[model samples]
Target chain A: MAQGQHHIIPIRMLAIVFGLLLFLTLATVITAQIDLGLVNVPLALAIAGSKAILVALVFMALKYDNKVNLLVLVLGVVFAVVFLALTLADTELRGTIGITEPGTTELTVEPAESE
Target chain B: MSSTGTTLKHYFVNHEQQFDAAKLGMWLFLVTEILLFSGMFVAYAVYRSWHPEVFAQASELLDWRLGALNTVVLLASSFTVALSIHFVQKGENDKVVVLLLMTLLCAAIFMVVKYFEYSGKFAHGVFPGAGFEPQGIIDGKDYSKYDIPFAPQFFSIYFVMTGIHGVHVLVGMGVFVWLVTRVARGHFSPQWYTPVELTGLYWHLVDIIWIFLFPLLYLI
Candidate 1:
C-alpha cells in the first residue's frame, strides 16, 4: 500500500480478533458467575474494555488509519474518563462533613413493601 | 456494474483527501455519540455505587444468558461488517454483498432477542419509571420480592440504556440494508468505498457500547 492509501487488513487478522472477542465474552460471563468479591466488577469492566478497544482498533481500522483519527478517539475517551471521574468524585464525596468519615452513603429511598 | 466507483468531490484535492476528510467527520460524529452514551454511563455508575445491593439484586432479574447471546451476535455482526469492508477494498462486490447481508441478519437476530427480553420483563410487570411494578414469580425467583426502593432506578436505567441501544441496532440494520442495495448496484469499489467504511465504524461503535452494557447491566 502507498503512504496515504488505505491499509487492507488481512482476513486472518480479522478472524483472529473475532475469536479473541468471543473468548473474552465467554471469559467475562464465566468470571462473573464466579464469586470474586470486589474483583468481579473491575474484572468484568476490564474485559469489556478490552473488547471495545479491540473492536475500535482492528474492526474500525483505527490501527491503520490516520493518526489524527486516533487522536480524536483518544481525546474523546480521555474526556469521557474525565467526565466520569469528575462526576463520581462529587457524587461520592457529597454531604461528607468530617475528614475521618468516608462517604459511603446510600440513597435513603425507603424500601417498598413487597406486593 | 463493477466498473462504477465513487467520483471525487470538487472540494477535496484527491481521493485520499476526500476519504480522510469523510472519515474524520465520521469520527467526530462518533465522539458525539460517545459523549451521548457517557451521560447514561455516569448515571449507571452513580446509581450503582449508591445502591450496590439494590443494583445487584435488580440485575438478577436480567438473564445473563440472553445478554451473552446478544453480545456474541453483535460481535459476529461487527466481524461481518469488517469482512465486508475487506472485500469491498478488494473489489469483491459479491462477497461484500453477502457479508453485509450476514451483518443485517445478525442485527435482526439481536433485535429479536432484545424484543423477547423486553417483552418478558413487561410480562412480569417489570416496567421502568412510574409503571414500576413486579408481580408473581418465575423459576422461584419472586419478581414481587424485588420491588424495593432504588430497584426502579435499576430497571429504569436498564430500559433506557438498552432501549436506546436497541434503537441504534435498528438504525444500523436500516443502514446495512441501504448499503446492501448499494453494494448490489456496485456503488462501492477498491478505488472508493467510504460509505461502507463509515457504516462499519458506526456498527463497530454500537457493538463497543454493547460490550460495556452487557457486563455492567447483565453481569452486574
Candidate 2:
C-alpha cells in the first residue's frame, strides 16, 4: 500500500484499551455516589479523558492523520469545550451577595457594661 | 472517467490522488460532525452549570457498567473495522469478513447492553421523558431527593446523540454487509479498494462521535 498509511489497531490492543475504558467509566460512576465535592469533577474528567484518547488514537487512527489534520481536530474540540467554560465563567463571576444558607441568621446583641 | 486511461479511471487520476482526496473529504465531513455535536455539548455545559446538582443526580441514575461496556465495545469495533479496512487493502477477503463480522458482533453487544440498561431503567421509572421519578421510598421521610426537572433533559440529549450513533452503527453494518457481498463476488481487487477505505472512514467517524459522547454525556 501507500507509505505512512494508517496503522490498523490490533484486536488485542483494542480489547485491552476497551477493557480499561469500561473499567474507568464504571469506577467513575460508582465514585459519583460518594460526596467528594470538587474531587468529583476531576475524577469524571480523568475517566472521560482516558476514553477520549483511546478512541482518538486507537479507533480513529488519529495517529495516522498528518500533523495538520490532528491540529484541526484537536483545536476544534478545545475551542468548543472552552466555549462552554467561558459561559460557566459568567455565572462564577457573580458574587454570592444575597445568596446565603437557609439557617444562617445574624444576631445583634446589646453591648455589655464590662468594666 | 478520470484524466487517466479508461481502466485506471476506476480509482483516481493516479493512486496518489485516489487516497488523499478521499481522506481529505472524510476529515472535513468529520469536522462538521464534530461541530454539530459541539452544539449539544454547549447545551449540556449550560444545563450542567445551571443545575450541577440535578445533572449529577440524574447522571447517578445511569448504570455505569453498561456505559462502560458500550465504550469498550465501540473501541473494539473500531479496531475490527480498521482491521477490516487493512485486510481489504491487502486483498485478504477472508480476513476482512472475519474482522467485519467481529465488528458487527461488537455492535450487537452494545445494543444488547443498551437494551438491558434502558429496560431496567424503565422498570424503575427512570426513562427519558415523564416516566422518571427520583424517590425510591428510602426511610419513608418523603425525602426531597434533590430531584431536578432539567436533568432528564440531558438524557434526551444523551439518547439523541447515542441514538443517532446507534443508527450509524447499523448503517456501518449495512456497509460491511455490502462489502461482504461484493467481496464474495470477487468484485474487489488489490489494486482498487476505495469502498473499503471509504467505509473505514465512515466507521472511524462513528467511533469519533462516541469518543466525544462517552465523555460529554457519561463522565460529567
TM-score of chain A of each: 0.78, 0.68
Per-residue CA lDDT of candidate 2, range B32-92, in tens? 7777777777777777777777776666566555676787787778777766766665667
Model 1 TM-score (2 dp) = 0.92
Displacement of residue B57 (Cα, Å) in model 2 is: 1.6
Q: Write the per-residue lDDT of candidate 1 for residues A12-110, one digit (tens) a residue.
A: 999999999999999999999999999999999999999999998999988888899999999999999999999999989976443333344453445
Against the hidden reference, what TM-scores do the models get? 0.92, 0.74
Residues A1-115 of candidate 2 have per-residue lDDT tens digits of 4422445456676667667766776676677667687887777677667766776676556776655667767777777777777866766665554456544435334446698
Tell me, by TM-score, which candidate is best: 1
